[model samples]
Target: MTRDATSFDALYKAEPDPWNYETSAYEAEKYRRCLALLPRCRYPRGLEIGCSIGVMSAEIAQRCDSLLALDFAQTAVARARARGIPNARFEVATIPAEWPAGRWDLIVLSEVLYYLGPAELDRTVTLVAKSLAAGGCCLVAGYTGPTETTLSALDVQDRLLHGLAEAHPRHAIYKDRDASWIAAIFECRTCPAGG
Candidate 1:
């Protein structure tokens, strides 16, 4: 099962910026790497899951014509909305349960999947694959850190690799000197052979 919304709610209640995402240089660098890895310069439609505070979403919004940013925590959602990106929409939604309604050209799964258990991870990955538009891509990024959650970064990446079959996956391992984060992009096979 995915980590309950209550725990996240409690986390935000205790501290608004629980992950230090607002002032972390590490997070800023990861966001840079993520933006660089996207195949297209501009995506017509995009979705960002676990978009805490919308710091990264603000940058992503510039690259997308329409963006939907979701988080299970309402506090996070409110803070994200305050970023005031006109093209982006922020909402409170849990993954694999409160999924969006349409497919997307770019789907971002950043620092969020490791919170889900094996079953939820698998199901969420499957749903991600099913939701990708033709020739679209999904970006999955997470850090290799000690966590209270049930799934690790490796576990989530493994599930993504196995669950999203039939896609051309690209792995961008960000081990800059001593950094510990992995970002992967899976592009759907929308075209036929040689056509």
Candidate 2:
């Protein structure tokens, strides 16, 4: 089953920061872990999908020459944009369909992939493979615990591993069960290896 815009809209309608990402300790630590796991210290260009409220986007912008953060919900995008980070841009765009132009040294799918079905996630993976700069990496983080959503964090990582097999990607898994989240960093091997 596809989780559509309405579900997300209702979420945003209830509260600006529905997930408490701005104040949650779990979220703060997860963001820290994601940043720590990056192979490179700085990325030339980075794209963060589903960057709700720009809480993490602001942090990530510090580590990138340029960053674009996109969310499907307009409220989320608006909240994220309000942060006013100079190096980061926020937009409303649905993934695998309204992708931005140009490749990126880093593409982040944080806590968002479980909202999709298998086929849609497959399309998203394909887009990541095509949009990623050679030797660039895609970092995917998600909550593994029970949720209303159909897919789990483990399911999302499994799809990435099997679907991107042709690209010969290098994978790193990091988990904090207490925080109920897991993240995987996949570095594409299709191009000449570079940091």
Candidate 3:
């Protein structure tokens, strides 16, 4: 079965922060790398999918004027909203089903892709490609490889459409090796004249 938004809802229902934001070394370094590699220094509106308990959202909040952090479970949403994370607006919503209309300057899919199967992931990539504003960038990273749990590494999975390359003919990919796992960066396609 594909890991849809429901998979995360059930996951978050069991634990508000399934990834252990406060104590996990892996999550800390991953968020650090994500922010440093961003194409822009500032974004007006950002979107973070599968925000869990909003740890990553708090970090992302530093770079954007406003952030829309989303999780599938109400339990996660309640805690995320209560975290009083700066410049953040928390909402409980499912992926693809509850995506905001128009465009975004930044989108973070950190560690959330593995739960989804190929088809849904492809649809997500399509959405990412279309939803991005001109010159905007989307950062897609996941737990590099498999774990004892249901998590699948974004590195090994072919389910996601974009190849794990920092610089494709159309875009770029940079894989950073950390103590725990590798973080991959995928930039969007640039147009002829500019962004």
Candidate 4:
């Protein structure tokens, strides 16, 4: 089953930085590598899923004209909003259910997809493919470590790639993997100039 919002809310209530997003050297490196994997230097519109407290959102916002960051937990959203990222907006939202309307030039899924059940994961893949602009890109970063969630990171990646293949034609432009994590970028081929 997908991890529910209440659990995440409780986690944030108990610890503002449950994942140590701000101070962890590992996470810092992961963010750097993930950002480096993006195909383009800038995106006009970007969406970040599961942006817990805007740590990564802050980095992503630097490369986007406008960024909308979402988290399932309201407490997390509040913290993210407090970051005061001028070009980024933080909102409380549950994925595969309450996605925002409109296409995005960049979509980021960072260490979050493995929490979803099979059905929800499939729905999210469809949403991502359909909402991505013709020349947009999707960046997926996952923890390769063992987990108690509905899917493993590698499993989520495989399912996402397969589902995307069925929904749209995209190029897997970049990929990086190590013992602890994996990251990849998929870019749409039909984008017009400057898209």
User: Could you give candidate 3's per-residue lDDT for residues 27-113 as a string of tens digits?
Assistant: 787789867888668988899988888888898898999999987777777888988976899998777767778778788887777
List runs of model 4 lying over 4 Å from the truth: 193-195
* RMSD (CA, Å), each prediction: 3.1, 2.4, 3.5, 1.6
- Model 1 clashes, total count: 0
RMSD to native, candidate 1: 3.1
Q: Which run of 10 residues does model 3 get worst, by summed lDDT?
A: 159-168
lDDT of 1 at 84: 87
Taking all chains together, the TM-score of candidate 4 against the true structure is 0.95
In model 1, residue pairs whose N, Cα or C atoms come closer than 3 Å (at least 3 residues apart or on different chains), thus clashing, are none
What residue runs in model 2 are displaced by over 4 Å at the alpha carbon?
A: 169-179, 189-195
Error of 1 at 176 (Å): 8.8
Ranking by lDDT: 4, 2, 1, 3
lDDT of 4 by residue, 1-195 (tens): 566899889999999998899999999999999899887899999999999989999999999999999999999999999999999999889998998999999999999999888888989998998898888888888998767786888888888777766666656568887679999888877857576
Per-residue lDDT tens digits for candidate 1, residues 1-195, read 356788778888889888788899987888888788777798899999999888999988989999999999888888899888999999999887888988888899888998876777777887887788877778888887677767877778777866765444532222221268787777775753365
Off by over 4 Å in 1: 167-178, 192-195
Score every model by TM-score.
0.88, 0.90, 0.80, 0.95
For candidate 2, write residues 1-195 as lDDT tens digits: 556766786788889888898899878988998878887888899999888789999988998999999988888788888888999999988886888889898888888888888788899888877778877778888887888778888898778756655555454444333357787777765555554
Better model by TM-score: candidate 1 vs candidate 3:
1
Which residue pairs collide in model 4, if any?
Answer: none
Q: What is the C-alpha lDDT of each candidate?
A: 0.80, 0.81, 0.71, 0.89
Q: Which pairs of residues clash in candidate 2, taking residues 3 or more apart in a chain or in different chains?
A: none
